[model samples]
Target: MNTGAVVRLTEATGVGRAVVGGKAAVLAELSVAGFAVPAGFVVTGAAPDDPELGGWMAEEAARLGGPRFAVRSSAAAEDLPDASYAGLYETRLDVPADRLAAAVRECFAAADSPRVADYRRNRGGDAAAMAVLVQVMVDAVAAGVAFTAHPLTGDRRQTVVTATQGFGEALVSGQAIGEEWLSTGHRATLSRRGPARVLTARQAEEVADLARLVAERYDGPQDVEWAIDRDGRLWLLQARPMTALPPPVSWAVPGPGLWMRNFRLGEWLPEPGTPLFATWLLPLLEAGYLDGMQATVGVRVPFRWTLVNGWYYNAPPVPSAALLVRVLRDGRRRAVTILFHALVQVGRDPAAADRAVLSALDRQWREQELPRYRRLVTVAAAEDPAADPRRLAEIVDQLGRHAGIALWYLAIVGGSAWKMEACLTRFARRHLAEVLPDADGGAQILLRGLSGAAPAFDAHAVLSADWYHPVAAELPTITAVTQSGDDRQSALAVARTAAEQRCAAALADRPRRLAQFETLLRVTQRYTVIREQQARTFTLAWPVLRRCARRLGQHLAEIGAISAIDDVFFCTRPELDTTATTDHAALTSAVAERREQWERQRRIAAPLTLGHPPRLIGDVIERTVQRARPAGTTAEHGSEVIVGHPASAGQATGPVRIITDPRDFPTFAGGDVLVARATAPAWTPLFARAAAVVTDGGTLAAHASLVAREYGIPAVVGTGNATSRLHSGQRVTVNGTDGTVTVHP
Candidate 1:
């Protein structure tokens, strides 16, 4: 062979076999196997010594009508039975016609890198001359990397090939990893099927056939890269030996406790009842913890009745704690609308709107705020502190209470998120059927709209014109309307700006405070952290026992009847009639099956499980807890009232109309009081007509509270269950000052 001349793998390997690497050798073998092989010239190690070889190869590539060929590295010493030096060198895809020579040279350099040398040394090989393979790129119909035996478990009975759309390089280069399967070595075509997807029947046979050819020629098990062109012919571009095999074992989970070791709860929450409360308490005290979550974190939780019954399953599961902390530090910043919605729900009225807003806020707090807060608390507590003994004691006490409050909040938020998702889905199913054919994507659509403040409210116009103001007539007018109104317009505008500033300040502070609480929660909940710290010989602080009763009251604004569970492990589906406007029968059955599965999946330690009969466990648990009550056990006056958090700094009274859902819109006349659990994107339609809004959960930044303020209506939020606390038609005064609701009996 001429040292500077380029030759086809077929030509060179057929006559001069020692010139190229295993990759080109396999291509030559495939060419001989009656498979379609692209025209390619192999430039051997002679190119490195003779500069003229580069120009000759480029000229040759130009002669072949160079659209772009793959310039891949093929080291003569590589792709042996003991090692496949994959990805140690370079493969430049779609190289330009003029740049083919340069690309080939770069591959030569890469193949000669220290990494390649180290790999060769470790795998018991010598650095030898490299070959440059320049091939006409095939317009691949399908492409993948195949193994003759299972690389993971070393099962020779199965051959695995993971295919993806477009080029197969992505699969090899770690840009993408394809779906895989175990096959009986049959050559069946692959197709997408249901949730499991990628059904490859008989494809295994084709893989094995290829593998058999490789083993016959190369005398060992080979890792092969194959591609099918538009003409329906399989061509093997490269093949190498398997390095090592996994010890055989049954990998599938065999009932309970089989793969329990794999579960990582640290990614989700802190372990319950850890003595380290210091790490969990601080974020609860952060001001910004609640509001900025939706904006800072993606994935809003839905809080509604229908969703309460929906199955809670996160696909592919969240990352481990280490990964989450990394993600938090990395580039996945949350969308703007999420933050906006989160801010809106921060201190807004939860009762005035439907269940949707309540759910969203709850979800934000739980998933985003809580996780970060937990990490923060954990890290902070582990660090040195210089606080006085009394102050430290007080802080410990505060942390304990904070954990309790967080737990309660999380439960409420989780329940609300599930319900909201279901409610929106059901709404889309029943009402938006004409508009939306597929209800599956409804929640996503709803969330998109809700995230944006799509529906604007004209609060100033309403208040000025007394047009849609429910409390317009309720305000007492002085004789001759001499209301001491000097520069009323400017003063009102200035005052409003100042008030808005204060609200904005409060909104901004939520995330930080939330971080504090979340950290403490994490420290308290994670047993692993405690053990890990202890093993490191770190001092574990004694937990301060705070009154759970007071903390529970503070966290839960309103408590309805509470059910005690004799067995927390066993869950039940409650029965409801058609009057509840739900498909309860279908839901209960679905939930029952799901609950059992989830419990199995969760697999709480045996110590945590109560040895009660499964059927009676649900009801008995419900009966054991004290009836849920809101904070403050003061006597109630018989009156119509709407109670909520002090979102806006003022309150106005008007006619009360109790609405349990967003569908109860027709009953709400303009200026009539709107009462509900929470608001959602769909519930914005009613914001224009309501006088003032009230809710059980929310900060000043909540959706209803924002719309109420924007629409110039007074709002109260975080009153717990505003609807449950306030009667239908009773007259009462909402005291925004000191955050109280008083009734005029």
Candidate 2:
């Protein structure tokens, strides 16, 4: 194989990976593709260990104008997608021109070291064929690795860049804890640890773009190594398909107090909130929450909504000495009573202590909160922004203020449904575990649909699908699976009947127990239906709000305040509200900047709880309210299994269709297991076609759960990493009965 003396960096682009090896081949290809690469050459013939090699190599180094060089082994088997034999071979950095041959020999020798031999054998490689690369060493100011996709969430839309001062080796070799940035093409979000930064925002974004471009050409995500010289010029060092990307690790709380995402705020707005939603609506929503708490709970609950990594997280007020004092001062015995229930309650069913307060809240929602919200939404929805363009700002302002408060009421009512569910599950599990199989299904029987009938929906009007998805969402087809009059709507319906019959027969001898069970079942059933209905009703003004913003956006675009109509989502309410006198140029730049930041934030997974994790007191309140813990909400899981709450029963095996955005709705095929972070009302149409359902965030009371059971498909919810762990077209067996998903190769 001694066909050449050496291959120059540019000329090596025409050489094969077999000759120049993986690292060298990629660098050469990068140079050919017009990417900035340091001047280099690869020594290609097999006799790298020849004793007299140093003299000629030093002469060649001098010819290339190098005072120092970086010599690394580029084995044919190195940097492979299946097995990146990284660090198994030697890399000699800062080799003086006179030491080129020694560095090359060292790299060549390391290729046959015991570790490399073992790696190649384990990964089923033929014997190593090594090429040694010597490149002009970069006088790096900062250098590091960049992943074209978010390694944590497997979100390809995000690029993760890490850097440290001086050499790339310090970061890659685990010698330095440096700066980290997440980029979404247009934005670079640096993790600030100290006062100084290795790369500026613009420089980090350039690094991200470099990685993204390489991935685009290669048609897959790339693990790119890069360096920035003292001159601030970026250079591509090496690139290869990423291998064994790690699962999520850090979910440290992003804020303070008791924070959570997959509950009140996360229930619908599961993904990171857009800039407009975060900046304008979320704060207003928080204010409304405070209002609703005052109305429903009789004292203002310390509540706030925060945007962490662009995801909406709610910080529920923690009960405290101060809160107790405030509640006593306000003369709201209702707040004190609930706090007493949370603090003093200890029983087989902790939620039982709060039943009275819970009932009061339900009534408040029905009589006071729901009506006010309904009235507000009606007025907001009635205003036609198109016909009255002048009133767009007014409509937008009113919606932002009222919509948040309206949804807060929805949460208040829906929260009762969640508690009733826990109470019902606890009662069933304790008393009827033998007869009922599981508390979830036992509870499901009494809670499946509105008591006697499913509420009819005009499917077309529901999603207003023409705007988001190419195909309009459809309604689930009705089916009967019974003999004569007991015709079951689904397998679940049959199971529900069987469970109900078992419960009835089991408690027949005890009239008191039967009566109690019946009462609990009725309330749980009623709230279950109402929760879904309220969720739908509260968002009625969304179309109005979005349309008004867009109308404002059209005018903004016409006046050159933003680049596109959709960019309106990136503008703050203040900017849009004062449009006539606003600095349009400044607004345009702010919108563009916000658009990038939102994109970057959206790619990273938001922590479920931000700040110190809840302690004993918080646990007690949560346990009483939510007894059945949401499963698999941690960082670790089996290689091929995803665990979550079994929202619906009946197993099915099918290909996955993960819908992160509503635009992906059209790609869903019938019988595919629909996966998502969470589903909103607009997402319900996908249920008509999904074979089974899975969600990264949601509970048994979520849209996916209710709709899947309605559609007679299996569903699992609250597997925190389902969307990241599974990809589209991957086959999976969803055991909704056991709440386990098995990924197939």
| Residue-by-residue lDDT tens digits, candidate 2, 51-87 | 5455556666887897889898887888888888888
CA lDDT of every candidate: 0.44, 0.69
Question: What TM-score does candidate 1 reach?
Answer: 0.35
- The per-residue C-alpha lDDT of model 2 at residue 272 equals 66
The runs of at least 3 residues in candidate 1 whose Cα sits more than 4 Å from the true structure, single-residue gaps closed, are 1-5, 14-18, 51-66, 121-125, 185-212, 215-219, 250-745
Once superposed on the true structure, which residue ranges of model 2 sit more than 4 Å away at CA? 1-254, 337-364, 367-372, 386-390, 452-498, 618-636, 709-712
lDDT value for model 2: 0.69
For each candidate in turn, the TM-score is 0.35, 0.64
lDDT of 1 at 637: 24
